[model samples]
Target: MPSMIEVRAPLEIKVDPQGGWELAFWVLDSFNYATPFRAMLIEIAEALAQHPIRSVSLPDYIVDEDFVEGTLLFNGSSLRVYYEHALSYLTLANDDRGVLTIVAQRVQSRIALI
Candidate 1:
């Protein structure tokens, strides 16, 4: 079975004016390292080919130690995605039943006229 962890539920995704993606409103600290959390990021990355998701970094097996700060599960250019495993800095996400909402915002800041 996959490991489970709590994040600030209601995984909200947004695109800024410059077309930058954003995720998470709370900090992800400390996790069940032994059991890797099935983050939706990976699935989203696979589903969305047009997105700029480079890769998803999951935990290694045989690693029974608790997840500490600096652990990563997502990778991309100009995007810093890290999982900090710390008990003192943790919050349980109660609403997001693991479904990530994708908000597609259309930005037409610069349109070339033919």
Candidate 2:
């Protein structure tokens, strides 16, 4: 039997006119297992869904010459969420939601798991 999956809504949901919602949906759908990655994605979605436009303060860090702007929070021991702009694609570790969605769509092609 397949394991059960839990779904929860975040406090807010903000999507850019360009493609933020689409990107977020794709990222949520890419989970194959209930691993940390999947949980992290769900947590992010829930947080966004609940607090859509609200800003959550996170740590700061410098990247290259320009500072990577946004709140920073630890997703896990190895992962970090670097949220830059609201309604725009946010970066999770090395992959951004938009990029991840694109990759997931490309790999699955005609079908989507989530």
Candidate 3:
């Protein structure tokens, strides 16, 4: 099996009349973390707009519990990311409501077995 598979996520962008563009608020909403983490999320968003993402996964030996949920401040409200599994799936929650979610569709790493 491959180490990772490319995945594409449709992003929302807004273009003003003057030819300036910016990501929708919802896209920024999920990136309420430290500078590096936020920058990484922004990079992912920008990359998704161009093509599929292929190299954004943890090593196979990493376990789910090794990942930790993240919380941060956004517009005076609390935003959080819940890691369903290490870099494979996550949910972005804002002030108790889920605003965004991401799932790596073809990832081979195992989170659990039933």
Candidate 4:
């Protein structure tokens, strides 16, 4: 399994003037080292933000009407984004199982470990 770390800060969902959506990222003090990773996340976020809530396509790993959880692969990294949707905003979703946190991990190649 890859080592995962939650991105607790620097994530925000923004609303466009035309009622579309976008994901904004602030300066993450500790995450400055992962510029490429952040870029990939931004690309994914933009894809999801450009569309309407109900119309957005999410991974079918967890089937729920309002909550979504799925892992995405970009090159050699794995990113997981999960959140609950309201009428106009995204909320941190939690349940008896646990909170679905946004996390990222690098998928290292086995041959590279040699």
Error of 4 at 5 (Å): 25
| Candidate 2 residue spans exceeding 4 A from truth | 1-42, 45-57, 60-76, 94-114
lDDT of 1 by residue, 4-108 (tens): 233444334544322344444332434534323334333334333324234444445334444322222222222323333444122111222222232111111
Candidates in order, TM-scores: namely 0.32, 0.21, 0.29, 0.26
Any residue pairs clashing in model 4, and if so which? none
Whole-model lDDT per candidate: 0.32, 0.32, 0.31, 0.31
Clashing pairs in 3: none
Q: Which residue runs does candidate 3 get wrong by more than 4 Å?
A: 1-7, 11-67, 96-114
lDDT of 4 by residue, 25-85 (tens): 2322332333233233334444433222332335543232443444443323333334333
Question: Candidate 3, residue 28: CA error in Å?
Answer: 19
lDDT of 2 by residue, 42-69 (tens): 3453443323123234433333212123
Q: Flag regions of model 4 displaced more than 4 Å.
A: 1-58, 61-64, 87-114
Runs with alpha carbons beyond 4 Å of true place in candidate 1 = 1-8, 13-22, 25-30, 38-40, 50-77, 87-114
Cα-based lDDT at residue 52, candidate 1 = 25
lDDT score for candidate 2 against the true structure: 0.32
